[model samples]
Target: MRAISIPLPGGPEVLTLGEHPDPDPGPGQVLIEVAAAGVNRADVSQRLGHYPSPPGTSPLPGMEVSGTIVALGRGVVGRSIGDRVCALLPSGGYASLVVAEAALLLDVPDSMNLVDAAGLPETLATVWSNVFMLAGLRAGETLLVHGGSSGIGTTAIQLARAHGALVATTAGTDEKLAACERLGAVILINYRTEDFVERLLDATDGRGADVILDAIGGAYLDRNLNALAPRGRLAIIGNQSAARGTVDVRTLMSKWLTIHGSTLRARPSEEKAAIMASVRENVWPFVVAGQVVPVIDQRIPFAEAARAHRRLEASEHIGKLLLIP
Candidate 1:
């Protein structure tokens, strides 16, 4: 199997393409012949030695992929070889082959492009788990998604809108914000030019958002609280900025706000399986009906994985990027 390996923690240039021993399925796992792998900010962090793979997981950096099952391990039931599937992985998605727990795999419909399916698992799991499952974003509520043009952001916009929530988003550029708008974002904040907290407050008549999906981490924590309505929920999935932030405890207590932080990569397999189950039950219908779709910005060749990292780091692309193996 060929994979992009991070031999050292450094820049994108350090991602080396090399042949690795083929991985076989273990108990309750399945071997997948990869079609495409999703490129995410976490991958870049891993390359830079900031996020290491979870213990006993693949050292290679990649968390999601779409492929066809080639073999099934013992104790794996209700799945078979040749099934088209997308899987959430702890690591090792950037390769020609990967071994995944069967419970974490979702069936990819024949109608959807297999390569594009690669982009769905991680983002969908993250958004569905944090925003809906954890935050309990109800219909008619407002959801303010930071980085609205990102993979998580785009998925959040569509899914929230489909679930009957009003969507607001922050992006750095007009073009990106426009993309968010087209995807159902009603309030667009150019984070580079405007204060999102103020804008969100104004747009909601001072009520602010009922739920906020924030990836900016500590840098936006205080403002995120300010942007929320009373009893609002804030789900933080990434710390793209500094990890630490000072919070105003008074505001949190006064408003009865809730803040949650999580990462999908390091989660236990059973937990990921539960999240995937929820997604399949609640979100997959929307996907099959085309109400929710994977928004891909670019597809880079597997050998040129470095280019994908560069594009993600530069923030030059909106939506998901894929590596074709």
Candidate 2:
């Protein structure tokens, strides 16, 4: 099997394709022959030596994969050889073969191609867990998503709107904003030219957003607080701009805002499995109905993994990027 390995992790140049032994399924796990893997900002961070894989997990960068199940490990049930599936992985997805816990697997939708399915697991689980399950977003509420053109952002916009919430999102360019609008975002904030806090408040008649999904961590903390409605929930999943920032205790106390921070890559298997189950039951239907789809910018060959990393780091894409393995 061929896999992309990061020897030292300084830049995309560190990623090199080389022969590696195929992974076998362990107890309660499934062995998949990978067809495609999704490239995420997390991968870039890992390449730059900022985020390391969890202990006892593969050192590879990919976190999600779509493939055919070639074998099932002992104790695995209800899944079999030759089943087409997509799964969330703790690591090691950037290869031709990877092992994933069976409980975290999702059946690939009949309506979607395998390449597109590769883009679902990470974004689906992240958005569903943080935005819906953790924040408890409900119908008739206004939800604001930062980085609306991103993989997580695009998924968040559609899922929030599909569940009956009014969607507002921020993107840097007119093209990205237009893409967000096509995905059911009613309020579009061009962060390069306008203030998202003011735009969100005006769109909601000065009540602010009931739920806010933010990836730009400390840099947006103050504005995010001001953009929230009383009792609103704010979920932070990434710290792309900066890792540390100060929050106003007075504003938080006055509004009674709830804050949540989470990372999916290092969670225990049971929690990830639970998130996958909820996504399958609640979000898969939307994909099957064509209400939500994976918006892919491009697919690069697995051997050219370095280019994929550069594409993600450049922030030139409107959605997910895939690596054909």
Candidate 3:
């Protein structure tokens, strides 16, 4: 099998396609013949040495894949071989073949093509776990999102809206904000020209947002709390700008806010399985119904993985970017 592997951590040039041993399914796992893999920010971070692969996981960069199941391991049931499935892989998505736990597998919607199905697992899992499961984003409440142009942001926007919540998102430009609007985000704030906290407060009629999904952690910490409603919940998934920043505990105390942070790939196997199960039971129907769709900005061949990394790093894309293997 051909897989993109990084010999050392550095620039995108480190991502190279080469022949590697094919992976086989172990107990409770399944082997998929990969059709496409979603190129994610985590892949770029892993390439640059910031996000390391989990212990005992493959060293490959990809975390999600869409493919046909060619083999099934022992203890796997319900799904069968030759099924068209997309799955959240712990690793090994950059290859032609990947092995994933059966519980993480999802049946591709007949309405979706291979390229589109490739884009679902990571974004859906992220949104379901952080926004719905962890934050408990209830209907009629306000949800504020940073990085509105990102894959996670787009997915979060649609899911929150579909669940009957009011949504707001912050982007660097109007173009990106407009994209968020198309996905049901009502309040759009250009983080560069305007203050997100002030804009959010104004849009919510002086009542801060009930839920906040933030990728920018360090510099925005204080402002995020200020933007939250009383007893608000803030779910932090990434620290793209700065890893550490000071928080005003006095303000948090008065507001009675809850600050929760998490990463998907680093989680324990059982927890990841639980997230996948929730998606299968709750969100997968919405995806098949076409209420929320994957917005792909570009699709590059698997051999051009470096170019995919460059585009994501540039922050020029408004939606998900993919790699067709």
Candidate 4:
């Protein structure tokens, strides 16, 4: 198997495509012949030595993949060889072959391209777990998604809209904002020019958003609280800006707000399986109906994995990027 190996923690140039021993399935796991892998910000963080793979997991950077099952482990049931599927992985997705847990697999419909399916698992799991499962975003409520053009952001916009929630988003550029708008975001704010807190409040008649999906951590924490209505829920899934931020406790007390900080990669396997189960039950139908689609920015060759990292780090992509193996 050919996989991206990080010789050292540094820049994107450190990711090297090299031969590796093919990994085999273990108990309750399956081996997949990879068609493509999703590129995410976490991959870049791993390459830079900031986020290490969890104990006993693959040291490789990728976390999601689409492929055909070639082998199944003992105790795995209801799955077979040649089944088209996409899976959430703890690590090791950026390879020609990967070992995935059977419970984490989601069936890939024949109508969808296998390569495009690679981009869905991670983002869908992230958005579904954070926005729907944890935050409990209800119908008729408003959802404010920060970094609205990102993989998580794009998925959140569509999913929220499909669930009957009003969508608002913050992006850095006009083109990105327009893209978010086309994805069903009714309120689009250019963060580079407009103050999102003010815009959100003004658009909602001073009630603010009912739920906020924020990736910009420290830089936006205080403002995110201000942008929420009473009893609002804020889910923090990433800290792309900075790790530390100051927030007023009074805001939480006054508004009875809820804040949740989470990460998909570090979660336990059982928890992930539960999340995937909910995603398959609730989100898969929308996907099958073509109401929710993976917004792909580009697909790069596996050998050029470093270039993919650079693109993600520069925030140049409007949605998910894929690595073709």
Kindly give the stretch of ten consecutive residues in candidate 2 with the minimal lDDT sum: 107-116
TM-score of each: 0.98, 0.98, 0.98, 0.99
**Which model is ahead, 1 or 3, in terms of lDDT?**
1
Global Cα RMSD, each model = 0.9, 0.9, 0.9, 0.7
For candidate 2, give the lDDT. Answer: 0.92
Task: Predict model 4's lDDT versus the native.
Answer: 0.94
| lDDT of candidates 1 onward, in order | 0.94, 0.92, 0.91, 0.94
The TM-score of candidate 3 is 0.98
Model 4 lDDT tens row, 2-97: 999888999999999999999989999999999999998888889989999999998988999999999999999999999999999999999999
How far off is residue 151 in model 1, in Å?
A: 0.5
Q: Give the alpha carbon lDDT tens digit for every residue of 87-156 in model 1.
A: 9999999999999999898999989999999999999999999999999999999999999999999999
On a 0 to 100 scale, what is the lDDT of residue 48 in model 4?
Answer: 89
Q: Lowest summed-lDDT stretch of 10 residues in model 3?
A: 109-118
> Which 10-residue window of candidate 1 scores lowest in summed lDDT?
238-247
Q: Candidate 4 regions off by >4 Å?
A: none
TM-score of 1: 0.98
